[model samples]
Target chain A: MRRLTDVGALREAYDLVIVGAGPAGMAAAVEAAGQDRAVLVLDENPGPGGQIYRAIGTAPLRDPRVLGAAYWEGAALADAFAAAEVDYLPGATVWHLDDALEIGVSAGARSAVLPARRVILATGALERPMPLRGWTLPGVMSVGAGQALLKAQGIAPTGRVVLAGCGPLLWLYAAQCIAAGAAPSLILETTPRANWRGALRHLPAFLATPYARKGLALMARVRRHLRVVPHVAALAIDAEDGALRVTWAEGTAFTADHVLLHQGVVPTLNLARAAGCAIAWDEGNACFAPVTDAWGTASLPGIAVAGDGAGIAGAEAAALRGRLTALEALRALGVLDEAGRDARAAPHRAALARWSRGRAFLDALYRPAPHFCAAPPDAMACRCEEVTGAALRDAARMGATGPNQLKAFLRCGMGPCQGRMCGPTITETIAQERGIHPREVGYMRLRTPAKPITLGEFAALRKTEADRRAVERR
Target chain B: MFRRLPEPPARRIGFSLDGVAVQGAEGDTVAAALLALGRTACRETAVSGAPRGPYCMMGVCFDCLVVIDGLGNRQGCLVPLREGMVVETQHGRRDAAR
Candidate 1:
């Protein structure tokens, strides 16, 4: 793991600048460079594997079937990056992108600029936070954060954690937590076991991956140590006497030292939005994802988005997308002949088809419960504005049937967290109140600087852009 | 079967939750203390009047919203408890004419 302290200052123009060094970015970097084009990968972490292949600090766990395959695949991608002589800028957060393919990146306290002919965004996704009461307690954390804590720091959030939420990640994290000896007190799965019947319909693809089968076995074993509460939702949590008093919808209550919550993932599309890429709402994931072609090319001619940035697919699909994207970029650059592009992309297309089946199955199995948006009048629907469900419903009753109208009245989507968590609920509440489908509600409009930017950086960028405009006018 | 433990003897602060005097911890959030007190029905739904409580403890779910200090809708989970925080139960969307 090489950490470049000053990547911005060490600038040579690359043929392609890939922001993110996870499964997709790394694969793209390797394949792009293999065509003898200079490829550079910038990542915010100390190492690759954005989240899924998160560095398992300890030795590979005994069960190599579950998360081990992803780990090994990440390791192989790292090796491939090394062999391809791709310039890797680790611990660098690419914060800004201009239409001219100019990128601004920050590494800790320092910053740099990298200009490239092509840019591929594979920024991946972040776990969706489902805010409920008592969620702000110290013992509460996202399932991804819990796994990251164990993998990155070798420390469990708490010994007797309660793993709650929906999705395969909940089970996967539960198994890992148990294996790490932090065994959760209970596993509250909002997704019912009946959902697995739908997942079973995709058994043909599941049977193909031996590692996935192993993951299932490990989950089964972990179930023995943990009380599996399927089709149950954590209604509330209250901290009492240094312990979390948790309530479920089924009239069951439990106490635990910590609570790990998961609600699947939403595509990390801040960079995509900043780059002016067109985004489409993905109803299945309850989030907006950048619209990308089969080859991961975005609406922009020179820019492409791959992996979770394009949509939320796991590591295997991300890797496949990455390779396919590279072939497309090569074709666009006029470097790859038609036959060459076909040969490189054919196998990936087949792998993607198989990988997508599992993702689709998981998506159906883990779709958020219908009652999630049914907030009570007093229940907070917008954490940012403290907008209550009552307030939202009143607005809807007043003929405010979309997020924008609701936002105008209540300021629900205008907050520091940027409505990533509350947007869907707010939209749904408005839809429910107006007796309309959620799809009828308009989506939140995204502006530049998708994330919070420092005042200093904003000022500097403003000055630079103003100066450039002045020069252009002259 | 886990037994519910007795409340700890921490310094309790009194606060008004929707005109109800509730006692909570000094460091506890308004939502946490409210949930601990068994006040599960935080508010009524704007359309259906469905009772809702805290769902996601972290600031993500937006399920534990209550009006604090006259602010119509605030995330109770994210708000820290003060000695005399005035929290009101949000009944429906803020614009609903009472």
Candidate 2:
């Protein structure tokens, strides 16, 4: 693998372009390069291992046990990707991807457009926004942010800490913090007690899966080491005495130096949405995912959505799905026949089936409470624009029907982060306000230059007549 | 709000945060380095001037916006910590002159 340093180093085109260097992107690169397809992988990070295995190659932690087995497993995939014949560019962000396979990417203060025959989006997931009061404070960050700090830089919160919200990741991060000698002061679990009844039907599959044992063990460890409050129905954080005070049920609160929150993760849909792939609201996951077939093929030909970007499957499943998408790409590119593709995909398919066994149970068990998902009127929804839920609700009442219209009315989704922090909440809040499904509310219509780019970078790009005509003064 | 664990020492890079020189280890992102120094709230929001810091170190949230080496509106979490860098807190909007 050759690491390209700048936009000028990239070729004019390639056989395949994979966005995101996570497990899915790396796995797909390994597969496609083995098939002798010219591949280019663009990643926004300084290294490989997109979020889940983040900093696997360059982790500051010396003890392998600190990060656990699942994280270390990514090293092998990274090694395989390193050995493959592919062009990998770190610190390169793909800002634009369209149906015709045109990619606008920027690296080192420069931008370039590259065309490819096939594209695979391994864009991965973002932590779901839990917009409670004071969530936008300086010391309050996502639990994933805390984990990323530990993994990449070997740092953890020093003073009193609190871990709040539902989902397996919250516990995993707590265990990691304990390993790092920064055990949290409290764990406020917000998993609704009623969810147990909904998740019970999938319990058999949960027990049969490997996650059951590992999850239970980790949960037990976290519970044993930390002060835990279960069935927490309400939560809020406020600034007091130059520190954060996290409040919950019946005015009970913990004075904390930092509050790390996580409920769950949802697929990052901007690139996929900008690419014009058909998307549908997933009831089980409670987020919109790109509509894709079994082979990870999206509605548009030559475009495939793989990994958690298609849906919120775990890392192993993402790798398997990556391989499946590579096989589909190979078949589409005429490098392999359909029968050959299926034959090569059999093992991955079987493994994926096993990996996805208990997902329904997890989804049902940890589905964030409605109050967490739909921000209350007083709480802020759009952190970038500082738009409140009440503002969005009022806009919805005043003739703004959907996210796009709400953007014009209130600028809810028109911020630097480009609706990522507020899109889901906006959709859910509008649906609840209008008495309709979130699907009917839909997502914001994202357009190119999805990520912020400098005017200098834009000017550096080779221009076409259409661009010239559009910008030229008549 | 954060503290660095005892690990094998790496080379320290010196940079200034709002004109005060601070030391960070090699390979640390600006956000991580700032957090390690307990310097949270890198910048105030452009909308409300409310104090904000890096929320998502993975670059999804724009709360980490800091002025680095005279370039405004840069994502501190995305940019690496280089030696002799000048990092400052961005007040409201980016200066048009910058």
Candidate 3:
């Protein structure tokens, strides 16, 4: 595998270019590489495994049980990707993506334009906006950030740390903390009420499936030592006496050096939306996702999305989907005829079906905390601009229809996160205030340069004198 | 305050934080290095001048912005800390800071 850095080194065109080196992107790369298609995988991180399998390359984690058996399985995937024929571009930020499969990337001080016949976006997910009182305080953090700290460098809160909100990842991190011989001061779980009435329909499917057993086991392990508080209605973080004072609806309060917050995760949809893909609101996960078919095809013919980027179907299902997408791409490229592609896709599809059966249950079971639907008036909705829920509600009253209009009225999604940290919260607030469906309200319209790029990096994109001339003419 | 088990930081990677020599481990990012040193406030708000630290170590929150080796507005969590690397707490927007 070749590592590309210079903009001058990128091939004029790739048969397939995959954005994100996560489970889906790398799995797709491995499959496409085996099929002899010229492939390229780009990631902002230094390694291949995405959030779920972070640090798989460098970490030979001394104890697999520390992170868990599911995480340890990523080692084989990384090894397979390492041995594959795909070209990997690490530390490369794919900021801009067009409908024609052209990708604008910034690597170090350099920039490059990658033109691809077909593009697969495995762009992954981001934590849903968790806006509570005093969250802007210095010590508050997302649970994902804590887990990343542990994964990247084995860092954990040595002092009193309170873990709040709900998600399997939160419990998994709690279990990891317990395994590492440390425990949180408290676990404030805003666990969603189980929709047993609506969920009975999916019971047969979940019973026959082995999904969420890992989550259950992690919860079991965490309950042994940590004091778990379930179903926190009102939550707030305040800086009191040099520590984060966490208070919930029932008035239970605790002070810790650090307060970690999480709701769940939503799709990273900047690339897909910028590529003009049709995004539909996923009712199950209570978030927006690019409307993608079984084979990972988006609304556009040449563009596809996989993994958490397409929807929130954990890691195992993402790998299967990556394989399915590669097969479909091969068939589209005329390399594998229809029958060959179908035969290859059959097993992957079946595996995805079994994995997906458990997915709906988790999505419904862990739907974001109810308060998000109508957050308190003063809660911070946008972390970047510091827009409050009250501000969003004011805009909604002024006939601001959706996220796009709110962006003009209050500058909600125009910050560095590019709406990732604020989109869900604003959408929920506006929808609730207007008494409409979140789907009808829609999400922020994303643009190019998804991540920040320095002007110097932009100038470096002119790789040649002809490019310089073209820029001058423009 | 946070250290990995069964390993004593492997080896020290020294860097400068606002002209002071700071010792960081090989695997530590600039933000992690700062955190390890108990320096919680990364920068002050442009509007309020209120101190803010690295909330989300994952590059989503832009709160971790710091000047790395004269390159301002770099995400401390995104860039890996290296020996002799100079980093300063970013004051405001890069242009305004300049």
Candidate 4:
């Protein structure tokens, strides 16, 4: 795949600029570019596969026994993206986007703004908040982090490893680790047992649905093989002598070299929120999601979001929504007539519903435990600034109602990692204290230079007389 | 705990970590390469000085920050390894003195 390193390699603008190249972004790019629109797909990673299908382009893992078939399925899209006419920019970090749909991108040391006629953000998901006592210990990390190692480099957690927390990925990775030949000794499930009634309400629909049925079958297989504990309430990890000791509510403890935690995933909303897209709280998903139409068109005329970033719909639905989003944008760009767009998007829209069938059950069953969401007082709420839960609660209690205002009093979200790590927990915590929704609590206000950029890099940004003349003409 | 299956990486290259010579595959990210060599603590916290390594390999968690070539605070997991590349354990924030 040809990567565009020079910020000015192409031009100042494009027909479309897709922000991510995951299952959604990849699908959107392939479809849009195949329609012959000037498309550019930019991602920070070295390849197209986002976290889910990461490293699929490098080489297809021959052994499905390891990463599972779904992991290898990304190869098909990777190959398609490789063959497409779209300009793909890997290793390009888009720092900021303005109200006018201009994207500030940093490729290595150089920075440039690419204005797009239409912008699609398939930014994807982040693991849910899982702060707990002693969680910051050396051997402890989120299962998402561990899975990234396995996906990107085939590196598995060695020694006595215990997979903890509740989510579909918890089981998926437990099974994957077992298949990969480094099975965890124990799987601690934190899903509240009472969620079964809520999950069962969606059971009839889930059983009839194709993707949900597959998920059920997979969970059954994992349950049968792996030793799993359900209804874990309290959790703490502390270093005892040398090994990390994991303790749960029932006075049960397990010592392991590494403890991988997973709860669930929330949409990554940096670009969407920064772009001023209208957002609403999705109580089912328990996060503020960008409001979008059936075809993934956002409230903004020129911007649209697809996949988990708009809301969590998993991989299959992400691709479907991506395809539908492309059709919507295509029609808006006058590439297709109304009838053509409708016809093309009809199949994907239907498929999206199919994939979304089991979501209610999954969301109900695995919604992050309350304590995990609103981390306990002792736990570190912001890993970057090293702020604790009590500190944030104090800030909110003392009339720091908004995240932006809270940031001034306490440096909770102002770290090199931005607010990705702590935003969810802080939002939920503030919302709980105020007796309001997270949307009412609001997210951190975004500013320019979204990702950290050095001054030296900024000063060296490529500029030309032609660019100046164009700006002057405007 | 982690081992590549029978299928080997497509290519191999050599690089240095904290001035020590270490060999890694072509597609290996600096973080992966370091993890393969059993070097998990890529840096220390800026405030607390606690050891931190590559927590999220997919460029999300900034715990994997390291000095690559001459650039400080580069995400180790995102930056690919190269022949004769120089990498140092990042002390903390780039603004902070090494």
Candidate 5:
């Protein structure tokens, strides 16, 4: 049942369909299929590893140290997934899902619609958008993207590279780049100095976790080889004379070949939001995530969101959460009794708690600067639609209050990315302009066909007679 | 924009970039191959025609959209490079015809 050859080879329905083949999805599939349930997993990447463990199975880098020991750990999960009696499909894009539990998928220039009794969305996280001036310039990219390049293809940033923004991931990536022999020349850290006071309250709990030690060692390793700038108040990038000019700290600037930026990662929310899950702003993580219960049940009856898509817990917690959610699903489906589910989930719950320890401290410490979140009037707010912060602000002032309204007024979130790149920024910008909380401003209203599919791919869908009659002209 | 590490021993795969022949390692995605080849700007925006490149490397950002073998708006970062594939810099909105 592993490795679907193409979309055409899919079954009409399954007991459970898990979207994304990252740690969470893989773990969930392993847990469910071990109970002999009909399970299927769909992933958009070329291989099983999602972004965090990108190319874990087929990474070009022979030396595991280049991507770190944590990334290499994905190998065991991927191997277990391969051994599990679960249908695994890579390069299969799930574009649409509905309350009926139907999933629309595109693969290899064709499309298919499949139904499932239950669905687990482990769609994982995306790099938080940093909408600085010239952010869309050729040489500018997110630090996560740079790490993906190195992990997936053994490519490293050439020439004078500059790493910027806050979060433990920034330092971890800098360390990886240094290990790859392409150490960045400088790092511009935007973590507010005042955050230390807020984060220190959680230091006792954080010290008990492995993250505290790992993070310290990683940062120390990076600092020895790179110039680290702390508490950067302002940052901007512009293409000047064919080079990227990065400016921060009161007009101080550096001309660089590449500018890698990152504040942190947030859940990839489009699929869940479009599928009608209730979403709320996570003040701790500074992002919007699906509202899920402890077992990962969303508002919808048959849908569950696991892993980072449910919240911003990292990979270890994601896998544990996945197993717990699968147990819940098994209980709901009569495969496991309530007592059985609870008994099986006990150890996973304990491990999840252990892995999730000190997350509060990390979130408090690495919350993106407000200025970076809202950006200035001149900075590009929507990379896809070319909408600027000023345009969004003006739209808000002119009575376009919500993201849905802003879409009509300025088409801010109507581009190919479907607001994924601009959703948070748009929410924050509107909230700032109207002097309201981001929750009040809300997020872009998303429709199905979450990722873009060519009209040709749509044409390949298996339409029912009712569907044809609904669209047919008299 | 990027350089290759000394190892990995990938088989060479050839593809066309804007009608020019280019070669990259076998496992490289189209965006990775383009960056490895030192071509920074991959496409012009459909909104304002400003040049953009692979910003996310993951498929989230559409900035790396390129034309592949007559198909327009294909995400270069998502698609793997193949031998003799036609890869063109997508300019503005995709042309309906190849």
Candidate 6:
């Protein structure tokens, strides 16, 4: 792999610049370059594989079927990226993207600015937070984070761990943890077995893909070592003496050295919004995702969003979307005739439809528990404003209609972390109290410099960039 | 059987919880300290009349929320308590009337 010391020094622009080097970004880079466009894939991580394709160095397990479909597909995808003449920038965080397709990238202390004719955002998703008592203890971690830690550092937080959460990834993660020799104490699954009946109805689609069957078999194998408790929720966690104590909603408790929680995921859309792309609220996921067309083009003509940044489709869907976006970009650039674009996108569209159904089934089965937004009277809802659930309840009782009104009264969304953590719950709680839908509750209005930036850095960057632009204009 | 050694002395800090003066270890987040003290209902939900405490400790989950000093609704796990800091129980995402 070639490493560029200074990405800023590359003065030549590209036909397409894809942000995030995961499945979506890699797929886009390969497909776009095949159409003869100069493609660049930028990622914050040291490698091309995103979190899903972590543990790259670990040899593929002997059981091809056991390794699951995405595993083999990922290997093939990696090969595709390797062969493509694409400029792959690892460890580069694209901090800002302007509407004009100008991107500001930061790597460690150094920063660079790159321009592109078109931008594709595949930034992926972040795990949803599931808070419980004693969760702040040292050994508690998100399942995704734990997996990342294991993949990147080969370290396990504890010898015995409890994996709790809902969704397909939960079992997959449990299997990985067991393979790493850290036997999970138990698997507390919020997704009820009854929900699988709905998933089973979509079995034909799953059967068509050997990977899907392998994923299911892997889960079954992992079930032998780990006790799987369905339709249960982890209520509270407390650290006592030296061990961690976890309580479940069904009136059961267990003790372990560490607890791993996995809620669903929400797309990371801050960069898309920062670039002034139009966004819409996804009622299904209770989050805002970037608005994209059939071809993954965002509201802006030259920019497109794919993968989780566009919506929380899994890896397969993301790859398909990435290829579709590339085809669209190629056709727009007159490289591919209409016939070519149509032929390439037809099979992808079919795959996307099949994947969407499976995802929808999973969504309904593992929908956030009804009481997810229910905070205790004294439980803190907005960590930023120090607002408690009780205080918000009082305001709601007094006719607080939405998050905006609740914010005005309690300053719930006005904190350094912004509302990324608390906004969904707050909106849901307000809607439930006022007898309204979450979408009707609206989202917290975000102002630019979406992430927290030190005043010094902001001022310095603004002045330097402004002077440079003025010189260029002259 | 070899007996496990006792935990070493923890670094402690003083802070107020809901107007009550309390002391916690340096490594303990405000939420951990509060939970260790058996304060289960850290905050209330605005709608469903459900109780919530700490859920995920890693900054991702927003469950363990408490009022610290003058700020309202801060993640207890993420914040380290300072000496003489005023921590209060949050009610429905706001401070209770004095």
DockQ of each: 0.04, 0.87, 0.64, 0.60, 0.86, 0.05
Q: A93-174, model 5: which lDDT tens digit per residue?
A: 8999989998999888889988999999999999998888888899999999899998988999988999989987889899
- Classify candidate 6 by CAPRI docking class: incorrect
lDDT of 5: 0.90
- By DockQ rank, best first, the candidates go 2, 5, 3, 4, 6, 1
Model 1 C-alpha lDDT per residue in residues A167-219, reported as the tens digit of each score = 77788778766666556788887886676776677666666766567767877
lDDT winner: 2
Cα DockQ of the candidate 1 complex: 0.04
Candidate 2 error regions (>4 Å): A464-474, B94-98
Better of 1 and 6 by TM-score: 1
Please list the residue runs of candidate 3 whose C-alpha ends up more than 4 Å from where it truly belongs after superposition.
Answer: A194-196, A211-213, A373-375, A463-474, B93-98
Tens-place lDDT per residue, model 4, A1-474, is: 456866767666788888889999999988887676788999988888988888885642457778888888888988888888888888888888767988888886778877898888888998876888777776677898878777776777888888889988988888777777777788888998788877888877777776676677777777777688888888888889978899986668988888888889998877777777888889899888889987788877789998899999899889888888888889878899999999887878777777788679788888876777876788888887888889998988899988888789988878887888888888888988788877788778756666888888876766678866977855
Worst 10 residues of 2 chain A by lDDT: A370-379
For model 6, residues A104-198, the per-residue Cα lDDT tens digits are: 77543355566788888888877765645544454566777655544433434545678887766777767765665555779887775566765
Identify the superior model by lDDT, candidate 1 or candidate 2. Answer: 2
Chain B TM-score, all predictions listed:
0.83, 0.92, 0.86, 0.87, 0.91, 0.80
- Classify candidate 4 by CAPRI docking class: medium
CA shift of B79, model 4, Å: 1.0
Displacement of the residue A72 alpha carbon in candidate 1, Å = 3.7
The C-alpha lDDT values of all candidates are: 0.69, 0.91, 0.81, 0.81, 0.90, 0.68
Between which residue pairs do clashes occur in model 2? none
